[model samples]
Target: MNITVHRPGELSAVDRAAWTALQSRAHLHGSPGLANPFLSPEFTLAIGHERRGVRIAVAREDGEPAGFLPFQRSATGVGRAIGLGISDCQGLVHRPGFDWNARELLRACGLSLWEFDHLVSGQAPFEAHASATFASPVIDLDQGYDTYLRHLRERSPKFIKGTLAKERRLSRDHGAVRYVHDERDPAVLTTLMGWKSAQYRRTGRSDRFAHPWIVRLLRRLFHTRADSFAGVLSVLYAADVPIAAHFGLRSERIHTCWFPAYDPAFAKYSPGLIMHLGMAEGAAADGIAHIDLGRGQKVYKDSLKTRELMVSEGWVALRHPVAFGHRARRAPVRALRNTVQTRPELFEPADKLLKRMGRIRSRGGE
Candidate 1:
């Protein structure tokens, strides 16, 4: 029942093999939050040249590699689950019957507060006392693309009908629609990142694409391949022109949707929505069961999701010297983040203003 935390890069060959095996046994894995190879020691070391402090947590059931957790602990003793905004899955990966105390793990990592946004569906520990959770919608395109469309019609008749009609309009006017899966084109991925960054600013959110390491990690994923952590880049083209693109990770049977971007010129076509539809069909064709769209309450996710799962997120305060000061200062910020969620409209004006200003600065045009 003893669990130990290790740096992700410190894992040996044997440890890596065991970790991957344990991951395979999970019912529905692949959040692309912290489980991807890009977050692994090999991948991280390859991409994270300057930032090498990310740690890997491994829980051993009597001296065997039972679980592994990947996270980055900051200077303030606060450990943030890696891929915070972008990753959907969070928390440690362990086999059944392995018990862990969240507090201990935080202590082992020399942290007071362990934070995660999409902390997986059933793995988080400290959330029982104070936490919030939500489901990410996913479309089931098992029987076939046509069958999925039928189910979508039955479940969300209006939404399915509208998107389909829009698809038709886009085809009739724009030209024939074409889908590319596992597209080897890095240019498509580059395009997606640009659009995603723009979308982030337009929606008044932090632009993750601005970070060099993160951007490098994604480009690496686009090139690397593994049965468990292969990149599945999807793109949609109209009249031979790229309109929408998404770069996600595929672990054999799970296609965890990640970065997505589309040309704003085709906003009426809703290429992003079309990209998801095409994604489901393509993923199902490749035998991928779950398209882990990650956690969020986006309208398009609701429109395409045929099922949902709830995941929780929160923080744990460490009992140390800096811990007290950290909590005292962070407490108000936590309250603010929670408040921002509850009273989104209150913050929307300010956020929008900031984003508008950024756009204005970038464009330098009226």
Candidate 2:
């Protein structure tokens, strides 16, 4: 087995092609964080330039490529996967039955620990799970949107009816129903950034929108046509005005929902929900299978999901005193998150209070 670390220009065309060819059926595997075309050359370059504590490597066994791992090695001997927060998916991309044994992989990568949040199920074994997140909603778009609606009628009657009714009202009251599939309009993107940043601030989280690298990365992703992480910006318009928009990444087949927003002006019409329904319809028409909504179990996600998939996340450690202590403190918090994730009723009070607080903050700002 030959394990080699690769820089942007260092990777041969064949290596790059073979590496990308191995992307799994899952939508997360196609995200720019793991499989983006921009990630190949530019991402490697940026990581080197910024020295944001990360490294890239590809492992090959018997002349057949085996795995690709992206990690950031902290000074204290902790190596974390790159773009964990920003990435909607995590893990090495390799052949079928890749056999991911977390400890062995960590040892191979020469790291003491590997951490992730939005990890794919059954990928790795982790210690000290930080949280259990929501299951992403998806629609299999192999058949036309109408066919999908049929499935929903049999499976999720209430959800389909409610969303469709709201969509009709939105169009009738607002204006004509219109949609811009793959709308690359920069103005819309800018608006979404503003809203997402506001959401971050109102919740007391660090504002990722303010980071120059992230901003540039998002813009870079918008224009990239490479196979790794092709940006898909879908929009819905009413009367020639965009009412709802979704920014996400796609492989040839899978569309992964990342960020979605709608005009507050048409909030009463549930423009975002309508847009999602339309997008789901479109995905089926486009021969796509799953539209990964990312992790989180919101009321909306639960309504849309066909089923649930459990994701495992935590860390493998080199075992330092401070790191051990950090994990210990996080243990209880993670348990709480897991309990809340498994039982929505238990988490509702806190979630509702937080949302209400956020609304109050937004109102105060206004």
Candidate 3:
């Protein structure tokens, strides 16, 4: 395979078309995970516009396009998945049977190490380097929304009943409740980001929206419209006031849920859950076959997911001093985190401690 590196914006029309074609072929040939919008060229281009260091490695065989790997590189030669912290899916989008050495690819790109958290399945070459794998919860809508609802009811009747009851109560207490699946208003996007930022601080997590690049990227994506990639904003409202909203990326067949938050004032109503249900219904209607909730452990995901997909986390490294140092510095921390995340006994206490820390931090800020 012949590999060439280019900035995401430097890709020619031929390269972009080949990238899209490869993605589509992968999806049609049973790798539905490639249908995620995060893996699309448009997403890479969007990130390139908002942030520096975004590049794509286009591989060709016999002078024909073969594969594409989009990533962000730091000055020290450390590479990460494009939109590393935010992208839910990561992998090389290549034609079936296309194969290349990971180290060779890294060398060609001048990367000493490539780190990824949510590497999608079917990545055989990279799979060998994965230190751990996690189940990514997903809501399958292939059988339609009604079928999924029936399955959900069978699995957790009480959860469904309770959430619906809360919705009724919310409507009665506030004004009539309603949902908008694809909200286009930019102001509403700002409101969603505010809620998400506050929630992040309240839960002892870094506020993603605090970064100007991320904010600009999302705003740009909000207006992006394409057949294979688009940003979808779904909102749940009470009498014209937004209570809960979600901003996620979607392709023709897959909707990957990204950021979701609800007004704490309506916490009693479980507006986030209500908004998810609305998203499911709308996604199904829009011909989306799956709603990928992404890799993580959450009560809501457990309650709503129809099944889970496997995603790996690890780094592919070339035998270089930088790669060795990177692994040495990160391995111990990652091992401890994996242990805590996999064991409920440790995870619960750690979560409580984090919440306490968050409360203290919030108080300090006040």
Better of 1 and 3 by TM-score: 3
lDDT of each: 0.72, 0.66, 0.92
How much is the lDDT of residue 219 in candidate 2? 70
What lDDT tens digits, residue by residue, belong to model 1 across residues 126-161?
A: 555235666666665556677777888898898877
Report how far residue 250 has shifted in candidate 3, in Å.
0.5
lDDT of 3 by residue, 47-132 (tens): 89987899999999999988899999999999998988799999999887888898899999999999999999999888889999
Native-vs-model 1 lDDT? Answer: 0.72
Question: Which residue pairs show backbone clashes in model 2?
Answer: 35-228, 36-228, 36-229, 37-228, 54-72, 134-296, 134-297, 141-284
Clashes of each: 3, 8, 0
| Tens-digit lDDT track of model 2 for 1-366 | 567765445677787677667653324543323332222433444445544666666777778877777677777667665676676666666665555566666666666667776666545444234355445556566566777678778888887888788878877887889777777788888877776777765654467887887877677667766544467778888887877788777765667778787767777877787888878877776666667776776667766666555545677665567567657876688777778767768777766777777677777874
Indicate which candidate wins on TM-score.
Answer: 3
Report the alpha-carbon TM-score of model 1 versus the true structure: 0.86
Query: Candidate 2: where are CA atoms >4 Å away?
Result: 7-10, 24-51, 124-134, 200-207, 320-326, 340-346, 363-366
Which is better, 1 or 2, measured by lDDT?
1
For residue 165, model 3's alpha carbon misses the true position, in angstroms, by 1.5
